[model samples]
Target: MAKIAFILLCHKDPDAIIKQAQSLTAVGDYMSIHFDARANPEHYQKIRDALKDNDHVTFAAKRIKCGWGEWSLVQATLNAVEAAVDAFPRATHFYMLSGDCMAIKSAEYAHELLDRRECDYIESFDYFDSDWIKTGWKEERLIYRHWFNERTQKRRFYWMFEAQKRLGITRDIPEDIEVMIGSQWWCLRRRTIEWILDFVKRRKDVMRFFRTTWIPDETFFQTIVRHLVPAHEIESRTLTFLMFSDYGMPVTFYNDHYDLLLSQDFLFARKISPDATELRRRLGVLYSSDGQRFQISNEGRSLYKFLTEKGRIGRRFASRFWEKESSLGRERELLIIVCKKWHVAKRLLERIRQMTNIPCIEYLFNEDSCPLPDLGGIQSTMGKRHRHRRALMRMLFDYYDTDRLIVCMDPANLDLLEDFGRDRSLTRILEIECHFSDEYLIGHAMRVGLAGDRTPPETIQRLLPTVRNDMTHESDRIRDANFENFLRVREVDPTDVSARAISEFLTVPQDKAHEILSHDHLYAD
Candidate 1:
């Protein structure tokens, strides 16, 4: 059997590392793991002991301190690849995966899929010209120097950073080198892996240049791979499915994503949490990677073609949006929550509770009678249009720097989350639309009052706990047979609060509210 080597870069989660390793490792195949140099020794030893008996398991001789979006991360990956190359000399293909990465298909099927491959699989794209990679995004990170700190801090640099930008003294990226980037995980032909190691040895200057460059791990290897002779030897797709939300965070794999992950055609799904056991069960049967034979059946060939063609671009865009904006601040206190309307928040809150029981996120209900306190009501904003709502939100964030995590709730409010995507200080804007269940949400709303009295909000507040309990435990019963009036806007905003609230929720210009609302009715048509 042709052996495959898996290079896994792991830090904390020991169980996750073992789970993923056991799944991918076959009798003939090998797993080379690189534990972050900073990982707890006790934790690291536990894993080492667990896999020590397995002759195919190898640990990287060189371990490095790895940080997110830093040079260290790439260094760790490179080390793992080199280790795998030495340990599994007979391995035919190399897969770069994280500890959190899991096989979405049977190991046998994955082996069969790669054994028939004619080209290397990796994602490569132009750094500057890619639709997602604009000048504003890369200039400071690429043009200026960024010191790599294991734990990066928000250093408040005033004029000096600006002065450096003006001076533009920098190690120039070679003009011939095309900067390409993609997900960190990839499957490579053994030749490709060797070529990368050789290329790095030859291009020490490129490595040195990337040292001070921001997060060179994302670029250094990517740039070198583009120069590989007969570029057709490479395919610009990583066979890993990482679904990112509009906020640019990976959408956690859940029951809802089963069909999307299955139909979309990818081999591995990445960054799964340790608790995603259900998702692992849903993926399918586990098989011994070593014993699997490379049979080219018609179904297998068709499946391979399907995986090759569909890279899930529509699910996740190339070059994440406002990535720089996401790493700021801690959302400790205060609460800014926005809902499309009252009932929508209730539905989303139910689902969020079901997924992660982190109680930090509070749902904002639309006050049908009066604008609910701190809850964003579309009716509270007078402007019926979108732009008006956007402008209103920016102004609100600027003027009212409330010490609260702003949990925004509507899909139209997605742009508003961009402002805070970089601001870690604010709470994540929990949008209901991104959860993949508008229709289910509508069902939840219908069930919200189905089991209890059909009384209006004024009466529902006292019985809210009972109603919610009924909704959760006795899901089959209808508390209220009538749900049409559940979303009624009882009082009109006599003031222009609706437009202001909508602008804040949507992140558009205040004046453009009229423009957005003008086409609101066309949504149905």
Candidate 2:
């Protein structure tokens, strides 16, 4: 006998909200919705009238004008939770959801999943240890009392924050409770909900303390549940699939994401686009249907990782050419292979690929098409070559999910080469072709015309000295006996490679190096 009571906080779109309520409602379950006090009266009335016939649906006893980062949001949710508890006395669990949230699976599946698990599912984490907050004051959110609405009254909010900082004003969290933070949505056991409400009733001072705290909705219940419930009884993950963008805004699901949404194992998803009528309709139908259990695909999680793991450099570099000119902060090792000829560059890349398992891209800055198969149909026009180069860089660092990137750069782009060399902030290794003999220069220059433009012997000779000088400032030079041995590129002579030299350059663990170099390609001639 497992039952769930869904408490939803809605502000707009009466039709959508009614559809969601109908999807979530079942014989043994219940639904309670709290309409924002600021929303139009007509919208609220329309929703109330639409769902009035459903025996399991009830509206909150009172409406609250909710604001982001304010206590009113929590109050509204609490009102809805109270109403749901009163109406559904047999409910064994209570789940908090938003107006935009829609079930991706049948309500029966969710009940069965929760029925077997005694532990509560919520995203509770330590306020200090967890790197959860992307921006804004972390400790200040708990220590400072915020009276102004941060979303609506931005000026007053910041001014009050600054005044408090100047006056050295602070507030103390109740010592009896451990402060925790998490997503506002959760699925808690009925007993847990009762305990939280009871604690709130008895601890009026704690409620008063949180009344002026910033974004208490994300913290109030999180802190209470973690404090009252045993750690082993709580699971620090949400039943709902929630993700935020780099700017800390929730990513919205659209019509194109219908198949992707169906592939996730999560019971529900939120912040869906209002205009996504097809997606809404499909999910609504699925939620009410008792279809066969879907297999866990984890496609959503993979997409999530793809979007979020493109670190500082990858994200910035990917958008640099198309968006704006900005400085890129290097986060990982970069390997630059500078060659005057594409044939030489290709040979070196093939040799490097055979020796080490690290990924290498050929002719990344070439004027023509790049050889990469993943870059679909993006013609490399002369004007868009720089954009393609940056896109390849992003693919190496982010999509390939590698710690090191090896790229062949054209020596003709002296300005770009000089920038890479002179930027002392970057941790990079530049391997330049040092076989500057007359015969080698003539042979390579003749083949260079096939790749792009022909390079005269004197031009390379003159540029070599300048390239060396520009690169010698902050780096050390190590020359090998063989012309093809690896040169630390400064004013150094020819470059070449050996297994030991390549292994040392990579600096990977001994076992990892063995694992990488043991491939059949490395052993082949």
Per-candidate TM vs. native? 0.55, 0.59
TM-score of 2: 0.59
lDDT of all predictions: 0.54, 0.67
For model 2, the local distance difference test gives 0.67
For model 2, the superposed segments whose C-alpha errors exceed 4 Å read 26-28, 304-525
| lDDT by residue for model 1 (209-271), tens | 777677676677667777874687778888887754322345345444444454445677764
* Backbone clash numbers for all candidates listed: 39, 6
lDDT of 2 by residue, 294-339 (tens): 7779677556556456543343112132233332223345666655
Clashing pairs in 2: 484-495, 484-496, 485-495, 485-496, 485-497, 486-496
> How much does candidate 1 score in TM-score?
0.55
